[model samples]
Target: MTGLMAGKRGLIMGLANDKSLAWGIAKALADQGAELAFSYQGDALRKRVAPLAEQLGSDFLIDCDVSDMAALDRTFDALKARWETIDFLVHAIGFSDKNELRGQFVDTSLDNFLLTMNISAYSFVAVTRRARAMMPEGGSILTLTYYGAEKVIPHYNVMGVAKAALETSVKYLAMDLGPENIRVNAISAGPIKTLAASGIGDFRYILKWNEYNSPLRRNVTIDDVGGSALYLLSDLASGVTGEIHHVDAGYNVVGMKAEDAPDI
Candidate 1:
């Protein structure tokens, strides 16, 4: 349909299922002819990713665990073997222990806090460092974030902090990789009903609130976020970097819900 990403090649991490934001972006890019490779955490995810990768005509699926350097090494190594250079990387990976995600920030256990940062924030930095090495021609790097990074979302606790750090890392990495013309940015999307989201308690409440307050009168979908992703990774957004683009149907711009509104 659209050929906006023609001839480009990108690697996408964190495609847990068809409902994933990463899947939405991948489908858009594939529709536009960007060659793609996917990475899954383990065999469980691999099964879901294989058929999807095949659907896009990509057989370049690899296993990667951000916490494991060995797995990270092999993933990029395999990509290098297939293509001398990569044009873009989509990092939709982030996690926090569900237990820590729902409580008071002050009560956060140091162990879980650090683990959250490592997985949700540090992984972005680590992956960018590796991807930059092979992007001699300069390319694009993108990560997913949330508005909670700036404002508190009741149960978003530690994950919000992690996303805040991840957003800052985007700026620093964008500056560091700038010399090479590599751009790094983030997308702060509204809530979606995905497997990962379902794990977060109180997600239903968050959804209902957004439906009533967001300017679009609805919650955002994976496709809406995907469209923004296509722009950032394409030459269309060559001048955009170190920025957090919100695809929340203008929800972030609102101060409060309408007075006459029934419960979302």
Candidate 2:
């Protein structure tokens, strides 16, 4: 419906480009009348994120490295300067080295594992802790996750483990924040061809496999994810918290390949 998020304002993190899932969610939130702020990690990404934020009517862009605690504090401090409070937060950030994404999980190096968990998982906790202060009146927080967190996907490697940690953190954060009326949840989205997905080896095959095997028999799009995200971030899901809602074309429920589907 129109104006589902009328008068609401929030931040969107981990946006890379127009094809990003963050972009999709941002468009949906803006369409429903939510004022948005975007965060980018570097100058290169600022170049890409600026135009897209403009399209969504958001000129508030902050550059912060999620892995750095000091940078995160400054990011929120900047937000506090512009808006005293916010109604919601969209955290779609996650990352791991492409080199480790292709290999076996056992082979994952200690350095990469820590880096992956810090960015892919712990950043949400750090941001949420900061955002909680801005939500003195309580608010909703949404983060992106994946089926790989629950089930194994080849080449997903350490990032999968990090997602698992992220999903668990959602529950704990929800419990911790719920006392203050703040809601926390996540969207375990299906495979989509975004800049982030490019790091996963044999990602195309994974996409085709899901397209063939999922109950919907098709791959999900960013718009598909955005719609779900809108509901979670809006008041419609006020009763929901500590939930891992799947936006994966029902792929999580399927135990085997479809009988009618051809081999990918």
Per-model TM against the reference: 0.97, 0.98
Q: Write the per-residue lDDT of candidate 2 for residues 1-264, one digit (tens) a residue.
A: 359999999999989998899999999999999999999998899999999999989899999999999999999999999999999999999999999989699999999999999999999999999999999989999999999999889999999999999999999999999999999999999999998999999999999999999999999999999999999999999999999999999999999889988977
For model 2 the local lDDT of residue 114 reads 95
Best by lDDT: 2
Error of 1 at 39 (Å): 0.6
TM accuracy, model 1: 0.97
**Relative to the true structure, how large is the alpha-carbon lDDT of every model?**
0.91, 0.95
Q: Candidate 1, residues 86-187: lDDT per residue as tens digits?
A: 999999998877886675888889998999899899999889989998899999999999999999898888889999999999999989999999999999
Worst 10 residues of 1 by lDDT: 255-264
Clashing pairs in 2: none
Best by TM-score: 2
